[model samples]
Target: MKKIVSLYSVAILLIIGSCSTNPFTGKKTLALVSNDQLFPMAFQQYGQFLTENKVVVGTAEAKRVEKVGMKIKAAAERWLTANGQAAVLQGYQWEYKLVDNKEVNAWCMPGGKIVFYTGILPITNDEATMAAVMGHEVAHALASHGAQRMSAGMLQQAGAVAVSVGTQNQSAEKQQMWMQAFGLGSQFGVMLPFSRDHESEADMIGLTLMAVAGYDPKNAVIVWERMSAKGGGQAPPEFMSTHPSNETRIAKITSQIPAAKAEAAKFGVVFK
Candidate 1:
C-alpha cells in the first residue's frame, strides 16, 4: 500500500503540473496545484472566514485596507506587465477585506483573496507603510505560495500515511511512537518552516512592488521595524517559530532596497 501510494504521488506530481521558474528569485518551482483548481476553494474559504469573523466595514481602516489593496494590485500588474508576466496574473480577482480582530495578523490566500485584521493597522501606521504590508501579502498570491503550501501538505500527508501503514501492525508502543513522529514530522518539516520562507520571498517581492507603485521601498524596512517593536513586550525568539526576526527581516529588506529602487527607476521614480 505504501509503495503504491508513493508511486501514485510521484506520478501525479510529475504529470499534473508544469514546473515554472520564479521571476522574483529565479528559483525552480513545482506547481502541481493549478490556479484553476485552487482559486475557487480559496474564494470559498475567504468567504467562509469573513462570514465567521467580525468583518468591519464602512470604517476608515476598512477603506484604507481597500485603498492599499488597490495600490498593491496596480503595482503587481505593473510589475508583471513590465516583466512580461502579465499572463501569470491574468485570472486574479483581487479582493481585500478588513476584519475587526486583535490578533495582529493579516494574510493573502490563493487567487488574490486577502484580509487584514484591524489590529495590525497600527503597526502599519501610514499609507506608505500600509503599502509595504499590502504588497507583501499580495506577493504571496502572485507567487503562488499558497499552492506550493497545499502541494507540500499533500506530500506530507502521503508520507504520514505511509509511515502509519508501515507501523500499524507493530506493538502498541511502536504505533504510538510512529504516530507522534508522523505528527511532528508532517508539521515541522513540511508545513511550518515553509511558511517562513514564503514570507521572506514575499517580502522581497513586496518591497519591489511597493517601490514600483511609487511608494518608497524604504517603507518596507520601517514596517518590519515597527512590527518587531510591537512584539518587544512579549514575543517568542524569532528562531523558535516560522517568522524571521524583525532585525533580520529588516536588514534583508534594507539590503534589497537598492535593487527595488533601481527597478522602480524604469517606472519613472525620482530619487530624493
Candidate 2:
C-alpha cells in the first residue's frame, strides 16, 4: 500500500515538474522535451520523409499548398503577436511540403514542419477548404500537441513502471497478466482520450486560425462534411480511437464557428 502510494506521488510530482504553458491554449501542458531538443529531431525526420517520398514541386497544386501554408503560418504569427506571445514561435522553422501520396492525411511536426498528402487534396477540393485543413495542422504545431503527446507517453510508461513495482510481490504469471491489463487500460482509457482531446483542441484552434487568415470558418464545417461523405470506410468508435469520429468533429467545429468568427473579429477579419 505504501509503495503504491509513494509511486503515484512520485508520478504526480514528475508530471507537474515537467509541464510548461502552451501560449496558444494558455494552458500548462507536458514539456519533457523542449523545442530545443525536439525541433532538430523533427526537422531531420521531416527531411528524411521528404527524401523518401515523391515531393510534388513546380506544380499549381503544390504552389497552392505552399501559399496557403504560408498564409496560415502568418496568421498564427499575427495572433501570437496580437496576444503578446510572439516569442512562442521564435524557434519555429516553418516548412510546408505537398507529398504525392494517396494517404489522405496531413500533419505538422514540432517546430512547424508540415506535410500534406496529395490524396487529401481531392477531399479539400478548393482553396478555402484547404486553408481550414492547413490551419488545423498548423494549430497542432503551435499548440505543441506533439510534445504533449510525447510527454503523456512518458507518463504512461512511468505509470506502468509503478504498476510493475507495486505488483512485484505477485507470482510471475499474475504479474505479466496485470501488466498486460494495465497496458490496455492505459492505452484505451487514458492515452486515446488524451489524443482525442488534442484533436479537438486543434479543431477549435484551426477554425479560429482559418477565420483569422481570411477563410470562412464555415468552410471548416464543410470540409469535415466532405471528409465524411467521401466514403473512407468506417472508423472505430470514438472511445477506441485516437481521433474523434467524423460526425463528432463536424459537430464540434460547427458549434465553434460563431466563436471563431468572434475571434477573427478581434483581428479585424470578418466573413460575409
Model 1 worst lDDT run, 10 consecutive residues: 11-20
The residue ranges of model 2 lying beyond 4 angstroms of the native Cα positions read none
> lDDT tens string, model 1, 38-62?
9999889888998899899998888
Q: Would you estimate the TM-scores of all the predictions?
A: 0.88, 0.97
Clashes within 3 Å, all models in order: 0, 0
Q: What is the lDDT of residue 19 in candidate 2?
A: 86
Model 2: per-residue lDDT, tens digit, 12-116? 888889888878778888888788888999999999998899999999889999999999998899999999998888799998899999998999999999999
lDDT of model 2 at residue 236?
77
The RMSD (Cα, Å) of candidate 2 is 1.2
